[model samples]
Target: MPRLMLTDEHWSKLRTILLEDRVYDKPEHRQTMEGILYRMRVGCPWQDLPDTFGLWNTIFRRFLLWTRKGILQRLFKKLISEPDFEWIFIDGSIVKAHQHSAGASSKYDEAIGKSKGGNTSKIHLAVDSYGLPIEFTITGGQPHDSKAAKPLIDMLPYANYIIADKGYDSEAIREQVRGRNSIPNIPRKSNSKVGNDDIDWCLYKYRHLVENTFEKLKKYRAIATRYDKLKANYESMVALACIMCWLPM
Candidate 1:
């Protein structure tokens, strides 16, 4: 209950994963990880992280190290090694960018961009039947869902069916889903004469699973809005949230 996020139960499981490589260990490791989760929950500036967690700057540096090394991303992928794939849902949602997240070095790739809602970033996510996150990507708000469909689906394992909204109604996307030996459950556009006669209406309702996953992840304040200036750092933040979703399982 001290200013920390991970419960003892959660820490036990996460400890096993974080230390699995045995590459590095320290007495402060648990506190460091807690600090990371704490920041994710509150979206506070590193220097503002509560003192009960200790030396905010120290914790922030460790997080930056892990983010740079792709440790968090790899850990998330490891937790999702086996997912409920019988039916998978994919979709995207946009997050507004905080003014504090601006002014990043131009050398780093950034995801935030101008949109009808001002600056924003979109999170493209895929979820299993149980609404657990499987894979996700970040992009500027202006890009269409189809631009991210291929790489996102490519990272996933084979599934019996792939579900999406009318935004992904393109034949190319459907064919890509077919390439995975999966049936596509995308509804056609309103303007198109071709109807959704083939769509599995019953199962398509479950497409809300991905939306729910996004909803849950966004509950963590850091994820609800874009604060990280670098795309990789933002992705690492999202990966940690996804790991939290899988951890409860």
Candidate 2:
């Protein structure tokens, strides 16, 4: 078989969650998962998958079923049940969407939009103190960072301080953060009446952690540029990437 991404220990942790109530061969399940990971890592078309992982169509269909069931998202949530919430960092990044990512059925928004960069999608992430991603939301690239701030903040697990850059410098965002009883460490815009005195310059330095998280996430070619026509599929790709980050911790 092609080199596997998950070691025995890692597979042990995931098998229960991934295989629950599934009536397939356990060993084949691992191979199917590794095949999916290979596609995500290499950003290859499903038809390009190697023979060792079984029929490409089977693996691709399983991925679609899992995405529809939210299995990957649930697994990520389960792994992050116990998180370090002292300092939460939030940020958004734009990913250029490949031409193939367009032309999806219109049942749901694909989260792709036309921008200066051509078709694009924005991923808004919330990371914990250790720079581990806890939650994220996908939007059209045209939306401002402040537009996603409230929803991202709302998903956070009880953080002591929420750190962000000036893009999230709106009073409404700060008030929302304050409403959650978390201190807002976002820097105020220069012309704003609010002074930077209340800002925690020290903790603000750690805001780079979220940027770093984005860097690591974008390392996966599939994530660097959108390939899936469906937003749910792309979101599952991201959830899997986030879970991989936690696996080593």
What is the TM-score of each predicted model, taking all chains together? 0.95, 0.96
Instruction: Give one digit per residue, the lDDT tens place, for model 2 in 180-203.
Output: 998888888889886898877888
lDDT of each: 0.87, 0.89
- TM-score attained by model 1: 0.95
lDDT of 1 by residue, 1-249 (tens): 556667888777767777885537687888888888888999988888878777998998888889888889888887875678899899999899998888897775598878777888999999988889888889888889988788899988889999999988899999999988999999999898988789889998888788888889999999998888888889999999999988767
Root-mean-square deviation per candidate: 1.4, 1.5
The residue ranges of model 2 lying beyond 4 angstroms of the native Cα positions read 19-25
